[model samples]
Target: MPLEIAIAGGGVGGMAAAIALQNQGHNVTIFEQARAFGRIGADVNLTPNAVHALDGLGIGDRLRATAARPEFRISRTWDSGEETSRLPMSAAAEVKYGAPQLTIHRADLLAALESALLPDTLHFGARVAGVSQTEDGVTLTFADGSTGDYDLVIGADGIHSAIRHALYGADDPQFTGLVSYRGVFVRGEAPDLPNLDSFTKWWGPTSDLQIVTFPLNRGEEVFVFATTGQKDWTEEGWTLSGDIDELRDIYKDFHPEARALLDACTEVTRSALHVRAPMPRWSEGRVVLLGDAAHPMVPFMAQGACMASEDAVVLGCALEGVEAEGLPAALERFAESRIPRTTRVQEGSLANDWLKKGGNADWVYGYDAWGALKYEVV
Candidate 1:
């Protein structure tokens, strides 16, 4: 019999897991709490690692078509308006990692993933409130008071995963002590800007601002993201509406180019970034966790979705032969293979975040996710 899998969460991670599992000829169902699922941010950078993961899913070209390949990564000093470092993206990234980093609208990526799902497989508005696993199978109880059973259960529901709470316990997500404000702008609206085809980040002491500018919809729309550390802001929800004036005041000291970009941003979204401390274990019995549910990190590294995609593939591969015996050992193997790497990434993202805030760019853009996968993993 094919493995019957119930996936909790319909975000990027969940959808990616579903695609991977379905490709392997298994039955997968995704339970999402939200009425709909799509990304709100203007644009997000998919490092080489994420591109590789997306390639594994056969969607890399589609993603690339809608993305802007930044020529380099540009960093500037917030107070002095001086270029700190300009790292080449195309040559260095391809020669070093075997893949090029990309930037695209979150919605475009989600739509691409969603278009691949089988009809009626994704159940929206079905929030999983609890999950219980026994020796034979796992049972899921949703917020709507419905119940379902599956041979395997995956908690890809994200940082505040309710399935994780059932497996472990309720705990607060660690506050990263930063707040982010994001919005998109039109290229035609902003004039005389360099149009550098590069990601720009401004650094300051105890706070930092970063912006992602990429062309979307065949160069028709420009997407942007601006984030700052707010000592007083505390909200974990990523989609919470943010104030534009606050963002304007926050970036008041940036260079004219950066300031013009910020000035063009209107109706920005805000959210408090949260970090999760590593858990000693990510699986218990037949139930296991994937993506942000297993390891949620600060967006500093932008590996959150990439790591989740990795988990889905690894978990499905590790559990390839469980039907003949059971899933305990497979689940254990998944944790062992994933935990160390993800933990390192978690710490690395946090460290990079701190460095970006302090204007340290020497090591940030030099990562090779494909090489890391080749050398680090056997």
Candidate 2:
């Protein structure tokens, strides 16, 4: 029996879930608060794990055409520019993990996911005000007081998820005493950067500060992200304008190549990092949480989006062809299977020590969501 499903928050995770469920012959609608998509300029890494899942969702070709496949993942000293470690990525990733690693603009990735959806499936400007579940179905209330009923609801609404709050109660996110400044610009602006063909990170004398740079849009643009320990950052949002001068001054002692990249950046945004401890459960009745809503972590591992996509794939497998009465049990199974992996990732990201010295990455990059879910359900 095909189920009628409603998903709150039309982000990467939500749209991926819709595609997976729709493939299983379910009717899925996504309610997003934003009026329309914006070309928000930040790059996201699509490791082999994420690539394999999206490839199964049928958007692999679109991603390859628009994203850059760096030849290496490099780590260097902040001031001296001494190479500490290098990991093969481009062809090596495909050979080792069965999918290529890609770095793409956030907008481009979202567009690919959005293009895979059916028409009239997305309801923009329909902010989710509240959600409640009855014995028979789930009711989703929009900010304008309109209501819709569905067989199940997915809360992929991000870190500050209303559905999560409704199900688990009011729990606040704790600041991690770290902040990041990020900017993206055309590659030509920073043409002289060394190792332009690789994704490189310059580690500070200690672990307290770092700057990362990589190519995106098939090497036509560059994305730079710098993180440092900060004590008093209160404003919260991904779009808060950052001081370009302050950014340069903070890294003035870095390698000349890194300094040049910062000098070329015309615009930047800063956001304080925050995390919520992983919840023991992710589903309640017909309403469940996915992605950042279920487990929000720092961006150290570059797996935040990847984990969300993985969750969507696993959840879709768990619910395929199930009767309405079995929905709760299926959702519980989905949460049970996903919590262990996501919790490990959440804790690892908080430590922020992924690949700094280069170690075996197979555990993180070689995961296959489709394979994991096979035989676990049905």
Candidate 3:
């Protein structure tokens, strides 16, 4: 059944979803709120599970080739630089999980996803003004007053999803009382930068105060993730200019290795952490929410992108057996199958109470989205 589908974002998750749906022989369109398609800021880790998901789409190997696979993920003390946790990564990870753990520039990941999508598949400057669903199908209205009709609509628009707000009401994101600064610098910028071939973390006395780094873009660059406790950060927007001095002061007691990385980074980006509570229902009528739009999580576990990537792949599995007339049931089944998994990720990522980044996550890493589960409307 070739159903018409529209995804409400052109980001990694949305693009991934668009491509997966397109592969299923469906008519899919990606509507982006931004004026164009591009990526800015942040480095991302595509662990074994996510790598497997992307591999299902046939682009994973090519994308992984552009990224660096660090040999070890070493967790250390912020002040003393003493090792706290050591885990195998890189080829070792591939041998264990069937896919290599990759640290990549966000741009590289985005490029891979975009390249697979046809040029005409995306519509930029198209903010979703409203979504309307009848018993027959769904339609989306953009801010500019144009309307597009589809048999199904997916809200992949991220945490502040207009489609999610329309389906569930205004559930504003609650700040997690934490702030983070992320930066990506060339390896040469910090000649003394430590552990370029290792996924490293300098854990402060408290969980909120930590600094993590890994190589990206074939070891030509390094990405740093630093966080500290901030009881209230009411600012709006995804990122802002971050002061390296302020970051230096936050971890003043950190090891000299961490300080050297900070001094080497001239610019940084800041964002106040925020997450949404679990939704009682992720779909209504013919519309459904996916990824951060449905279950936003903090970055403590770094599973945000991974979860979204999974959503894109699983949606295809959920829909392949259904016809357009059964789209609602397919969506319901999609939510049913995904909610628990994503809930585990949402709660687990909070302060890393359950799983730490780069730790042993065979259960999380071993999922095969295309082969997971299949559903059909009776």
* Model 1 TM-score, 2 decimals: 0.88
Estimate, for each residue in 131-238, the C-alpha lDDT of model 2 and write its tens digit. 998889999988899999999999999888989988989999888889889998788887767787788988887666888888888998888999878988779778
Enumerate clash totals for all models, in the order shown: 0, 0, 0
- Report lDDT per candidate: 0.73, 0.90, 0.83
Candidate with the larger TM-score of 2 and 3? 2
Candidate closest to the true structure, highest lDDT: 2
lDDT, model 3, position 237: 64
Please give the ranking of all candidate structures by lDDT, highest first, separated by commas. 2, 3, 1
Worst 10 residues of 2 by lDDT: 369-378
Question: Which candidate, 2 or 3, would have the higher lDDT against the true structure?
Answer: 2
Clashing pairs in 3: none
- Residue 221 of model 3 has an lDDT of 83
For model 3, what is the C-alpha lDDT against the true structure?
0.83
Can you tell me which runs of candidate 1 are displaced by over 4 Å?
38-42, 208-220, 232-236, 353-378
The 10 consecutive residues of candidate 3 with the worst lDDT sum are: 351-360
lDDT of 1 by residue, 300-369 (tens): 6667877876776677666655582468777887788778878988998887643343453323334432
